[model samples]
Target: MDQNEIQFSYRARDDRGVFEVVPRVDGTPLTDLIDKFETDAGMRPSGDAYGGLVPQFFRFGPMEDHFHGRLGDAKTPLLGCECGEWGCWPLLARITTTDDLVIWDAFEQPHRPARDYTGFGPFRFDRHRYDDALGKLSRAVDEGS
Candidate 1:
């Protein structure tokens, strides 16, 4: 491995072969991989794909259920909400294998290792977070135009 390169391995649910989460210096491999599964052609497989999972990072608390319902309807997983887009909610990640074993919040920004979060799941949402998420989701679902 190049001294500058970092990688992690997980078994994929699809024929994509053994999944290795790698952050490329030239671009974002994780995002690209997610995009493939999230596309219409791939049909967005369940488990760890973008739409397959719920948003764990939120500000003020977890969003409400209606938000989640809308989230379930969302085509893209890990979407950046108003809070997330502005960098209020920390970006987190969870890694899992076919056996259901998980490495919670395992990813980090290739450049910013000091930050508490970097990428998507192992989801670790607390009660307060969930409540807040549900509230936000409700607003998003009900109030969103």
Candidate 2:
């Protein structure tokens, strides 16, 4: 999530009682921009405690299920994974109830260096950012406006 990077904001609906996160980046009109605060963090392999460089990206990175308390909470929502694909670069996703499309400035995610292939298993995505998002949602709920 970068201020200069253009991202397509989308809200997922309960398609058959499931939250399907679909990215909408192409074919969208533009206008005066709004400021939205969304964030993400990445991981790179480090040592030989687990696996290797993970040669293949997961099919789906971390994402929200669009249910329960919020995207991140005690819920511990997973990040979108790029399953064994060439162009499967990890991404930051926003999970919403309605399909409200909006593009705005967001917090740039942390830069994670590629992990050293030392067979240290797979790298784990950061939890602090996710926890913060959940915290924001909780605060919104607490305000009770």
Candidate 3:
């Protein structure tokens, strides 16, 4: 199967004084991608209710036992509420990694379990490239840029 390229970029809302790093898949914002899927599925767009998680939570890799509670086995919180509280609204996905690939699939809206996100993604990425993008994000965060 073909893989999607993943990249991380920062967005700053000067009016709200909010700065965050957002994930982009295949050159489009991941949020927009999800919105497109929801729209196509005849569901209401999530709009501003959700946003990317804070930089610190992006520890992308194989699923582990350490991920419990709101993040069940193989799942990680990818996007969270714009209000800065993750539990309020989150877009979670099962993330699994192989030696050369990272896969994100089985998306869920914990707050709205009835909403099915079955066809949204099973996005695959080259491990090396994904790691490089993550490294860039880490450096940018450390530099406060």
Candidate 4:
């Protein structure tokens, strides 16, 4: 598998008996990856962040201008607070798309600008495959609802 390849899977959870679907990337929980990055960088990992892959807010497109936004730019929220609120703790990244590829880079921890995420990712994915993965996830979520 290519290092830049992106894949998505769900990590089901029982939150006080209420089932929740958290997304996983390349078979590893998204939050775990963030934690690992922090640890590797000699920083204490905050184990409270959670993946927030809600279809509406996370679909492949330009995000609503928030922390780092321009009038009609693209950005995506990858993770949110464990308390289930996205704005409280978000791990955002700029998503740039081309004819045959989708690139995720310029990561930011909105609330902690001082913390650098320079080496975390610049994950690139083939556009067709990326769309397929997201489409599958959307269908699964719709079916479950």
What TM-score do all the candidates reach, one by one?
Answer: 0.23, 0.21, 0.81, 0.75
Error of 2 at 10 (Å): 12
Ranking by lDDT: 3, 4, 1, 2
As for TM-score, the candidate ahead, 1 or 4, is 4
Higher-lDDT candidate of 2 and 4: 4
Residues 41-111 of candidate 3: C-alpha lDDT, one tens digit per residue:
77764666677655444443322221222344557777777765556777888877678988888999877
For all candidates in order, the CA lDDT equals: 0.31, 0.24, 0.70, 0.61
Show the colliding residue pairs in model 4.
none
Q: How many residue pairs clash in each candidate?
A: 25, 24, 0, 0
Least accurate 10 contiguous residues by lDDT in model 3: 61-70
lDDT of 4: 0.61
lDDT of 2 by residue, 1-145 (tens): 2211122222222322222222222222111110111111123321211110121232222223332225352321112322312123222223223232222111111233242212211212223433344345444333422
lDDT of 4 by residue, 1-145 (tens): 2435555554444553322335455666667888788777776546655555443433333222221234354566767766545677877888776678777688888788888999987777777877777676556666655
User: What are the per-residue Cα lDDT tens digits for candidate 1 across 23-112?
Assistant: 221234444544443353333232233211222322323233322323342221233212223133222343221232212344432223
Q: Which window of 10 residues has the lowest lDDT sum in candidate 1?
A: 1-10
Winner on TM-score between 2 and 3 is 3
